[model samples]
Target chain A: MELQGIYILWLRDLKRYIRARSRIIGSLGMPIFFLAFFGMGFRRVEIPSLPQNITYIDFLAPGIVSMVVLFTSTFSGISIVWDRQFGFLREIMVAPISRTTISLGRNLGGATTALIQGLIMIALSFLIGFKPSINGLLFAFVFMFLIAVAFTGIGIAISTFMHDIHGFQIVINFFVFPIFLLSGALFPISELPKFVATLALFDPLTYGVDGMRWAMIGYSEFNPLYDLAALLIFCVTIVFVSAALFSKMEVE
Target chain B: MEPIVVKNLTKTFNGFKAVDSINFTVKKGEIFGLLGPNGAGKTTTIKMLVTLLKPSSGEAKVAGYDVVKQPNMVRKNIGIVFQEPTLDLELTAKENLDFHARLYGLNKKRREERIKEVLKLVDLYDKANLQVKKFSGGMQRRLEIARGLLHFPKVLFLDEPTLGLDAQTRRKIWDYIIEMKEREDVTIILTTHYIEEADKLCDRVAIIDKGKIIALDDPENLKKMVGEDVVSLTVNDPERLIDELALEEIRKIVRIEDRLELSVVKGEIMIPRMVEIAQKVGVEVKSVSLRKPTLEDVFIHLTGREIREESGKNAFWRR
Candidate 1:
């Protein structure tokens, strides 16, 4: 029954995602913009320690992939607010299944869609002269999935407290921007001042960006295993909290 | 045994009573109604029974399962159509039913059969593949009902099932609602502010006002509480007029907007006497119309207030 509930919900989200052609263009557009502008502008600004053949675009490719996951997964979680506004949440709430099953379905659906969006970013990265090995592509897929799961959980948890799109957009503006900026997606955290670098280490997405950076460009400040562990723990905890909060959500 | 047994169910928001201590039971296969004006707690009461909101106090059992303690049990036995449209407008009619059926743990074979059954019951089989957004208002409402009955729930909650539709469309939805009830053999708890809807559809109605059930009985019995007929008199001095026309047959006298509505057993005999008293009292009788007691009249009789909103603000909600 749990699996069936999850499957139905996941399928519904997948259907909606496919139907909205503009959403694909919208989610993909931001990452490509960041990659093109940063990749072109920073090509000559070399960091001290350089590997044999990696360009700044190749270095920024994985961070942008993580950015893709961050955008798609979290926005997918915003469907909760839309569902509440449209009254579809009430239908699901009154059903005989546990809220946990519903949350799992939503997170998985968001993660899968985020993975697809990440895949698109990867394809887009290659087109823009950013290159990674086949092994790196496979690694990027796994790490991006984890990042998507974590960000979607965070978004769903945050949305349970938000009533409308305006509140959600405000939160996305205040919350998602800081997470992305502090995760060292644009610059290496090692170059930042002591306080800012310390703050960046605490961001869960830092691990995500760093882990994907290792896979895509073979450059990471921390051990890849620690980064994976932090993301895994963060994903599980946020997903659990999201489901608990959602179960208590009110409907008028 | 009754499938729904609500006892002293109460809900409050920030110290304001939304649903204050209401009790009633619905017999198996019966069409019961929670009839009240908007913000009079009709929707609040329905939400409580459907386990969408927790009551501030007291208890409710739907399909013999405690709404709070055994919400899943209550949910499994009951299906609800909210006052707002809860359908995934992006999904096809068949897909919507399939989604709901899967949540109820229906196997693929049973899911297929039930989807077909409910779609045909609502007479939307041909349009089953069409997205719900493509449906007209009436078609969307019918599809919602079909989705509600997809799992063959023991009790179905229709919250303003015909609300916001044209009169012709409303009548058509009514046909489908009644048809769904019989075909599914399910007890239905419908909440509506539409007086005639209660008169035509409900086997019993609990008329809620100011968070309380002011009257509860079958439509006929409730109307009988207001006597046989209502003779409404518009006069200059309604209070003085009532004193002079003290007919023993006059069951009740209510003043509503310069008009004195007299509920009487013998409206025919009393109308002339009322006119005579108005002349004697210099009441300046302007007009009088006698009509049979309807559910609306009964509601007004019990609550002493009209069902329609007079002021832009809701008096009940305004502390």
Candidate 2:
């Protein structure tokens, strides 16, 4: 857990991202575009009972930022698959380092990249007429980091099960997209039916989005304390599970 | 001291064993060659020794550390160059060596010194700052060897080191390998399909096939086991030739479709007498050649098949 190792891996990740300019933008840019268009398009739809008279754009901003962190972290897990394919994983594995160090370094690298992407989306939100308190902005940063760590683990776990790139894509489209939709990244969980709302309560991304929205727009149907607590529990559990499963993950 | 020792080592994939129960020891400052066909388990055996693949049934100790119980220690004591290119193409040659140096926890001054020395060792010092993507295949392979040596491990494992190189480049690599071995006194274990490569590079060789090692001895002794020389002659008459050469004096005579292979003590003089006898029997001689028995002949004698037949069975890196 040397910070130097983490920093080296972080630099490696950023360098890789910068090298693939179109991919970096495409992965983060498309989501920002949606945040802008939808935030503006839905300006008139306002919830009557919400405190602080939060606008629709302001309400959607936090969710978009959370989605940016989630997407970047999940996609970077595919990079692990590429590493395995290109023999890079073996190169690293053969080194005289603990497997835990290797996994931690990679996950930290992925999470850091996701946080940077989340920041870009947040900056973009300001240009699109969304407003939040300074305290809320700080909270958004912390929430994004936690979401990045949790989703990165889930993403890597998903990658371990896939045998090829095509299978990885199919998994993301089928599993990840549904999780995002069900977690209220596009719509409010309160508007869903009883069974769906109860199920959404269990979605880890739901807790993250709820906590972030509460911090940003200062309005929520669920208690912010509960949301924060659920997110912390979810993040810790996913991290442990991913680390344990990583030992059994084989390239061949 | 022995650099590598195996006690009934084996690795199985599902129901198929990739490395069967095999045991051998490599002494310090020695080059051990694992000679085999494509699917003859050389790579698997090396992987097990390098602590990359776990043995399914037995045990191995590399650099005096048990491969299973102390895998990290074993890995620390040995450097491995894989069959495929593993260097980061985007990184410069110096950067690649620097990364390996850091992985091995070398200090700054020593890391820099070792980088320069290893670059020179492989004769790539002038191209130290050049990116690997721009380097030729030979240069890239040389850089990989340089990186593997950065840690100054006690042993080095090279899996098919010169597999795809041209003959001239392959010879250059072999020269570097010999230089490295002499300079560092490092124990080297390499696997190869080329017979001459093993004969030239290894002090001793293990002939493996079908997940089993058929024989283990020095190259000279292995060749001697098949007799001193083999006289290969292409003859048109087969039945009459077999009847004529099937004398009690000859130890072994093998007949292919268009060739007669005979084991003899002095092939230089015996070849002429055999040709004279063939002419007396009116058997037209197409071509004649005589030489000492090679590692290929040793392999063929052990397995009853050619080395080229097992090339396409294993798809590397496939799940």
Least accurate 10 contiguous residues by lDDT in model 2 chain A: A1-10
Worst 10 residues of 1 chain B by lDDT: B310-319
Q: Residue A202 error for model 1, in Å? A: 0.8
**Model 1 DockQ (Cα-based):** 0.82
**Candidate 1 per-residue C-alpha lDDT over A143-192 given as tens digits, one digit per residue, 9 for 90 to 100:** 89888988888878877888988886677688888889889888888878
Local distance difference test, per candidate? Answer: 0.86, 0.81
Off by over 4 Å in 1: A49-52, B310-319
Q: Candidate 2's residue-wise lDDT over B199-249, tens digit each?
A: 999999999987888999999999987788888889999668878886554
lDDT string for model 1 (B1-319, tens) is: 6899999999999999999999999999889998888889988898888888899999998888999999889899988887778999999999999999999999999999989988888889999999999998888888888888888899999988887777898888888878777767899999888888998999999898889999899999999889899999998887787677676788788888788888988788888888887887677989999999988888778777887654223322211
- Chain A TM-score compared with the true chain A, each model in order: 0.96, 0.92
Cα lDDT tens digits, model 2, A90-157, are 77778887656666667888888899888888877888887877688788777788899888888777
Residue A217 of model 1: what lDDT?
77
Q: Candidate 2 — which residues are off by over 4 angstroms? A: A1-8, A46-52, B14-17, B129-131, B235-240, B247-251, B255-257, B272-286, B309-319
Q: Each candidate's DockQ score against the native complex?
A: 0.82, 0.48
Q: RMSD (Cα, Å) of candidate 2?
A: 3.1
